[model samples]
Target: MRPRKPALRPGKPMVRRGVPVGSPFRLLLLGASFALTGYAGVRLLADDWFAVAVWFVGAALLHDLVLLPLYAVADRSVVRGLDATGHRDRALYVRVPAALSGLLLLVWFPLISGRVERRYRLGTGLSPDGFLARWLLITAVLFGAAALLLALRLRRATKQRPPATH
Candidate 1:
């Protein structure tokens, strides 16, 4: 039997035209493209993609294998360290990434080299200093500028605030 089509009636609700793509087909196409891109990226990057991939994989492995415990231990250590009779800074965690990334960039200054030759490094994924270190350093410098601007605004706000009532 042939499929029946919806009838168009002028007075009743207007019949909708068929979509160029239905949700399922679009989703399948999207998933296939995603897979294709990943495959191409792996092929093009070959050994170098290994570093980023391995970093992510190592992060997962470490998180599963070691970091969870380490995190718990560190969290305990931090709670113990605040020796605060009661004073605690709520924004500390928010600032930690920006702060540590800056220190790391400084420490790994050599890795921040943007020389054209560094393009070769991407394919090999092997950086004497490591991709994370370099990317973090670059990101630190760029985003840290934004962080610094925030700090400056905070400083200015503090200076501008009215003195506490006596």
Candidate 2:
């Protein structure tokens, strides 16, 4: 005897073999992403495949062995400090800016620190001098915006709350 298919509710997602498959639009998006990744992989491999493979392996090892633990510890410390200060709910304000800053630093490290000045200038014919300043400015802006948002949220909450009783 064949197994009966499960009946899906009007608003519920479709499930196949006990796994939620999500909407057809999501499946189409996933397929398109996979195809794009495969195309990029083919083009990359057509170049220096060995160097790319080695770099990928090295990046994976470095992230797993070093970066992962470092960030985990840093995040835990932040959470602990916020929790102790009774402002744990406001951790996102600190985390978002720090994460954006860290990402910018990571992506532009060589240029920002002037390590690749000669190579970058040779390739692009432009000096890689102002990246550090620009990155710092962007980091400042992200933090300032996050702080402003937090201040507004606090003000709104205060206004919404009733007056304290004696």
Candidate 3:
């Protein structure tokens, strides 16, 4: 079903008719989410909160100060390299898989690095020895799929072009 356009006030900007600009429902949902987060934080703080607070602050600072610059530099390098090769369109294919793999590595660093091997085994009754291999396999699959998709897009683009006149 199509949305109905609502009449706008003389000075007001245009918006979809059925949806109000600055939706009250979105505001309500945002307020609800904040309230729930605050409630959870309070409950969590009731027991040994200092460490949790420290962790939260430290993670934010580390990501901002360290990881962000590191990744930004890496992305710039990728872009520069692709541009030099005259294949900038292929950058997204590389970037998407790399970003996904990086995220997976970041989230599972402890298991992947075997730093928490004992704790992991105690918690899950399984070895973390295979994490590296699994991560590698996942990274390989992501890149392979991305390459396939890039090839398909290139093929489609070529096919959509009209023939050149002699």
Candidate 4:
């Protein structure tokens, strides 16, 4: 005789064919996301599909071949430096701002560097000359804010420490 399956208890996920089914709300969100993705794919393919395909492939290759290794090395170096200085726990203070600044730089490189100033001006009737300065200012603000938060955390930590015996 075949062995009987165990009964499912309340709050436990339902199992079907060796797979666990997610909650109804999670499944609904998943289905909605799939539908949205399908709609976007159809719309994109209807337009200049070749350009989109090329952009996607080029982005993937660039990220895998160049960006990934460069960032990985940089991150490892930062972590190693922090660990050496006994500030490993403070690494996130540097990382978060740097990552945000890097993302902003990546997204606005042409404009930030003034390389697309003329084209941008002609297309949008607005000068793109301040992008570089604005980007620098924003980066400075991000780093400054991160430093302030780290200082506050350090102060709080020191205050909570037990008194040391002589």
Candidate 5:
């Protein structure tokens, strides 16, 4: 007598466990954004915490409407430059600047405000000199810190990824 091996199915759907990587992240992100918008709308309707509500809206607009476009342009320009010239270290020219800009916005605004009171110039709602200097100093410090972090990260990454064949 011959023993039969386990019968194999010709077609079977592979069962996957846990949340699919991208769908859950996308859902979570969208859900959080919706919640934030809902809260903001509720605040606006109530009109009790109007100033804070307005500021939140302004921040969101600044990021989504203004900052995003600027970054997209900058990213395209940097990538074009890298591609055109065939630069060896592409990330240095792109990610470093972006990271520094992010850090500057995150840290500089708060830190620099403590050093000097924001003075409004006559007539104009916003002036370049005060805004530029504060941001410039912040960005410079941020750039230096970002560069250091980048070097460390690059070193770590290099250690982890095996060398590729030509």
Candidate 6:
């Protein structure tokens, strides 16, 4: 005699046992992306792509081993500084703009500093002369905008609050 299987209710969607909460469509998409990445990686191996592959692996390892610790320490320092000051308000305003600007600088350092001017110009047919100035201006704008928004939000919040009684 066979054991009886549990029946699923009609209204609830069928969920696989041992799986965490997530949409079936999202799981399907994740599987497809992994498959496509594996396919591309295999194709790259066939084209004598060892150097590029090794460089990518090395870069990943370097970022994990070095950059991750450095950034973590910096962030911890900032948090500690805020804690020491006893004024933690608007930390997100500073952190968000600084993080975005740092990421932009990291991504565009070579172009911004003209270190790879010839290579960049050859590849894209565009000059890299203005990159440094543009990046600085963008950094300033990001911080300025963040500061303005924080000020506005604080002002509105203050207006909405009732006055403290003596």
TM-score per candidate: 0.30, 0.65, 0.61, 0.65, 0.39, 0.60
State model 4's lDDT.
0.87
CA lDDT, candidate 5, residue 77: 81
TM-score, cand. 2 vs. native: 0.65
Residue-wise lDDT of candidate 4 within 23-90, one digit each (tens)?
Answer: 67767788999999889988887888898878878899989999999998898899999999999988
In candidate 5, list every pair of residues with a backbone clash: none
Candidate 2: residue 45 Cα off by (Å): 13
| Collision pairs in model 1 | 48-123, 48-124, 48-125
Q: How accurate is candidate 1 locally (lDDT)?
A: 0.61
User: Runs in model 2 with CA error above 4 Å?
Assistant: 1-56
Q: lDDT by residue for model 5 over 46-125, one digit each (tens)?
A: 75576776787889999899988987787778777777887646546456766677766666664445443344334355
Separate clash counts for every candidate: 3, 0, 2, 0, 0, 0
lDDT of 6 by residue, 58-136 (tens): 8999899998998788877777788789857656777888889889989988888899999988999987789999998
- Model 6: residues with Cα > 4 Å off, grouped in runs: 1-57, 121-125
Question: What lDDT does model 2 reach?
Answer: 0.88
lDDT of 3 at 1: 58
Q: Lowest summed lDDT over 10 consecutive residues: which window, candidate 4? A: 6-15
lDDT (tens digit, per residue) of candidate 3 on 22-140: 65566678889999999998997877799989888989999999999999999989999999999877888989999999999999998898999998899999977999999999999
Task: Give Cα distance to truth, residue 36, candidate 2, Å.
Answer: 20
